[model samples]
Target: MADLKVGSGEDIIITSGLGSCVGVTLYNKSTKIGGMAHVMLPEFPANREQGNPAKYADTALDMLLDKLRKKRVNLNRLEAKMAGGAQMFNFSSSNDKMRIGARNIEAVERILQEKGIPILGAEVGENYGRTMELHNATGKVLIKTVKHDDIVL
Candidate 1:
């Protein structure tokens, strides 16, 4: 997770070449604090974070929120935006893991709802890759996809 804490000033964080990967940003407007994570899996083995929390959605979010809390950011004021959960490739494989992209998005959304953090915006789930940028100054997410026009959320 990448974080710009209180008094850190305006900073933009980005993750490029996302495929079957989700980039989630959490921000507190009042504190001007924000964090982003490049999530590869919806959940970890047994859903445990172990060492690298950023490797999974659930653990990554936990780590991010803890960081924000340490910076004195109000959890109640937190808003979330996400992007880049593309299918990435085509295969006839029936394995559920092959659908990791969609599952990653689902896990993220579920976690947000459970934490009472509203999803302000999202650009997810397609057959193409995406790159996402989080603007800490405005809490706006910029998404660029190969097959679709760029979008801001």
Candidate 2:
């Protein structure tokens, strides 16, 4: 659901209920600072100017990076880990608009690439919901799902 957070040191940022939504973490291991975003859509709506930026993958990472920049986290030292983007609903037609999870994943990856942030690991695209946590102190991302063993990325 449209939420984002930034933390430092031993803080752990967590997000749950990630069905068809993406959870992304940007971490600077040297500084022990990181940010997490629960992105609900692929891109921000072009017609709207007054919406939560955290709701869209295209805008969420920028917001997160700005916050991290304010905290003096070096962009050059940052790495990424991501989880979620589950296809919770089944669509009979092969319409792209129905593939929200896939679109979110693509948007996030593209944005990160444009920013020159390398993704260290990811757990994405399945039929189940997920929860993700970013451990700021360790730059470790933990992905939790109901049907599978907990994953560390």
Candidate 3:
């Protein structure tokens, strides 16, 4: 398992094999600071909520926005980009109700919209998995789908 790394305006953060999940990257151009969160579920676990808040879609977006704000980054200037959210499991399975990936994508979009952030780019929803890379300085997102080529969004 490769580690997801973040950088301040000069480096790129990357994650791979996002199946039935969502990957969110928030970047501050001025400070070149950014972070990426690979969210597996739409909401926080009901039984456990004391650990890292960034592990969840809603809380992670809030936390990322707050960090950028603290660094003097303009909220209106902040742009959002995302990738993943595939239907990885068999629909015939008993766990069909667990559409966590799609739920995660929806949650992320809603959060960004509510915060008034513009979605500059996205590559989400399909049967295939994806590998994503986020560049902090330029807010550029790159996505590589399974058995497919890489794309820069």
Candidate 4:
């Protein structure tokens, strides 16, 4: 599933159980408004499906950006960091959608570039899961994996 949260420096947004899902964060250093999205799917319908805005990469990014704008955060000052998007399940199928983890990473990166948000760091791709926390106060992303030491990006 996908979800989005936007908050100022006083807040810390967290997302967990990211197997083939990517946890992305966009942060504005000046305003200290951070936005995070737990993206499940790579894309959404062109017409915009009547579903959760945070349920897909396409819609989730848009919604998060809108929220950031509404909060008076300058887009030009924004940067992105991501974690998760692991290839959790192995499959013989070559279908792109089946490679959810990689697809999610690619889609998220593409969207962030389109929005002019530089990707400062990322912890993506592998055969594991991750939990991420975005600290709005310092623009730091804390990524925790079950079998590895904690990573800060």
**Candidate number achieving the greatest TM-score relative to the actual structure:** 2
Candidates by TM-score, descending order: 2, 4, 1, 3
Which of the numbered candidates is closest to the native, going by highest lDDT? 2
Clashes of each: 0, 0, 2, 0
Score residue 79 of candidate 2 by CA lDDT: 95
Candidate 4 local lDDT, 33-146, one digit each (tens): 999999998888678658776978988999999999999888899999998889988899899878889999999999988888999999999999999999999999999988
Candidate 3, residues 39-118, lDDT tens digits: the string is: 77676678994866666787777766776667677677776788888888666655735776778889999988888877
Give the clash total for candidate 4. Answer: 0
Q: Candidate 4 local accuracy as lDDT?
A: 0.91
* Model 2 per-residue lDDT at 14: 93
- Cα lDDT of candidate 1 equals 0.82
Clash pairs for candidate 4: none
- TM for every model, in the order presented, reads 0.89, 0.98, 0.83, 0.95
Q: Which is better, 2 or 3, measured by TM-score?
A: 2
Scored against the true structure, residue 35 in model 3 reaches a CA lDDT of 68
> In candidate 1, which residue ranges exceed 4 Å CA deviation?
1-8, 47-51
lDDT of 1 by residue, 48-148 (tens): 54656678888789988888888888999999998878897888998987998999999999999999999999888888888888788887889997678
Higher-scoring candidate on lDDT, 1 or 2: 2
For residue 74, model 3's alpha carbon misses the true position, in angstroms, by 1.7
| TM-score for predicted model 1 compared with the true structure | 0.89
- Candidate 3: Cα lDDT at 51: 62
lDDT of candidate 3 at residue 77, scale 0 to 100:
71
- What are the per-residue Cα lDDT tens digits for candidate 2 across 1-153? 798999998899999999889999999988899999999999999999798988999889989999999999999889998888889988899999999999999999999999999999999998999999998888889999898999999
In order, the Cα lDDT scores of the candidates are 0.82, 0.92, 0.75, 0.91
